[model samples]
Target: MIICELKNNQRTDALVSELVDIWEDSVRATHSFLTHADIETIKLYVPHAIKAVPHLFVARENTGSIHGFLGISGQKIEMLFIATQYRGHGLGKKLIQETMSLYPITDVVVNEQNQQAIGFYEHMGFEVYDRSAIDEHGGTFPILFMRKP
Candidate 1:
């Protein structure tokens, strides 16, 4: 698979919808801490967040269909999600490496309840430097602030 920057093409609308699906599927698989209500609530903000992201990239097959995406703002990775079937294939590491090549990514925040994600970030060379009792939006879920040395 090849990774490429997501451009606003004629298929932008359809692609955005697909990306949201990937996001939901990924969250459902790993975020066992979330209730149905919590998932629905967070879904409300994802589309808007996707639209507001300044930089976005996708991992695609030779057929050019996207299987995962990453969004970054400056040096922070605001979002990253792989289609459920694409996880554990090192595509996420590829995306991070590509993004880091383009930006000085020094930090990331992960939900403490999402152990899989926390482990993945740790494996990718980040270490927890701080903790918050609540998420960035003041939600009840705790968060871990990690940085790469």
Candidate 2:
């Protein structure tokens, strides 16, 4: 598998659709608090965000099929999603490593209810510095603000 940056023209409509599929599948596996309706609503905005994010990267196999992706806005990780089947692999770690090499990333936020994600970020050397009562979408699910220590 190869981890590489995605160029503008490389993000075709079909590729966005494939990335959305991965995003929804990963969210379904990890974000149990979200309803199907919520997923549908979030999916509506995914395409726009994919195009607007300043830095976007993907992990693909030898066949050039993307299995996971990371999106960054400046130094913060705006989004990172790995296909359910690809979670246990080091793809996520590799994505983070690649992003850090390119940007001075020090802050990230994770759904506080998602223990697995919190643990993963903590294991990755980030510490929770603060907490919010609601998520950015104004949802009840709280978020933990973390930064590298």
Candidate 3:
């Protein structure tokens, strides 16, 4: 498997949409810190962020089709998505490793009902630091902030 830098190509369109769908589903299943409008806002940010970063990697086969990607910005990992067909091939783990090589990541997963994701993040060595407070928008749901340090 070759993990190459994310390219500004047509493949990115599907990748962006897939990640947004993944995030939206995660929000619905978990009722997390996101509205549909917030998801839309993030979709707009992908192109600009991808262009600026050299570390966003697109995993590929010897044939060179896009299997997944890892995206990072600031101290945060913005997204990591493996194509459903390519999961369990260690691509997700590979994405995380490559992203961290470029920066010190402080990942924040809010309103996380998905135990699997929580486990995944923990397995990668992140620790919980802070939880959330109730608000009109944030609700009583706890926002868990995590860090690698």
The best candidate in terms of TM-score = 2
* Worst window of 10 by summed lDDT in candidate 1: 6-15
Clash-forming residue pairs, model 1: none
Q: Worst 10-residue stretch by lDDT in candidate 2?
A: 1-10
Candidate 2 colliding pairs, count: 0
Clashes of each: 0, 0, 0
Q: Against the correct fold, how does model 2 do in TM-score? A: 0.96
Which tens-of-lDDT digit does each residue in 1-149 have in candidate 3? 88766555543666656545544444444434557675566557655555555456677779866677776667876556566666566777887887677677777453454455567778888888876664324555455677777
- Report the error of model 2 at residue 102, Å: 1.4
- Write down the TM-score for model 1: 0.95
Q: Write the per-residue lDDT of candidate 2 for residues 73-128, one digit (tens) a residue.
A: 87799999999999988888999998899889999999998898898888889999
Candidate 1 residues 35-84, lDDT tens each? 99999999999987887788888899999778899998877788999989
Clashing pairs in 2: none
> lDDT values of the candidates?
0.89, 0.91, 0.63
Q: Model 1 off-target regions past 4 Å?
A: 8-11
Please state the error at residue 44 of candidate 2 in Å. 1.1
Candidate scoring better on lDDT of 2 and 3:
2
Model 3, TM vs. native: 0.63
Q: Candidate 2: where are CA atoms >4 Å away?
A: none
Q: 1 or 2: which has the higher lDDT?
A: 2
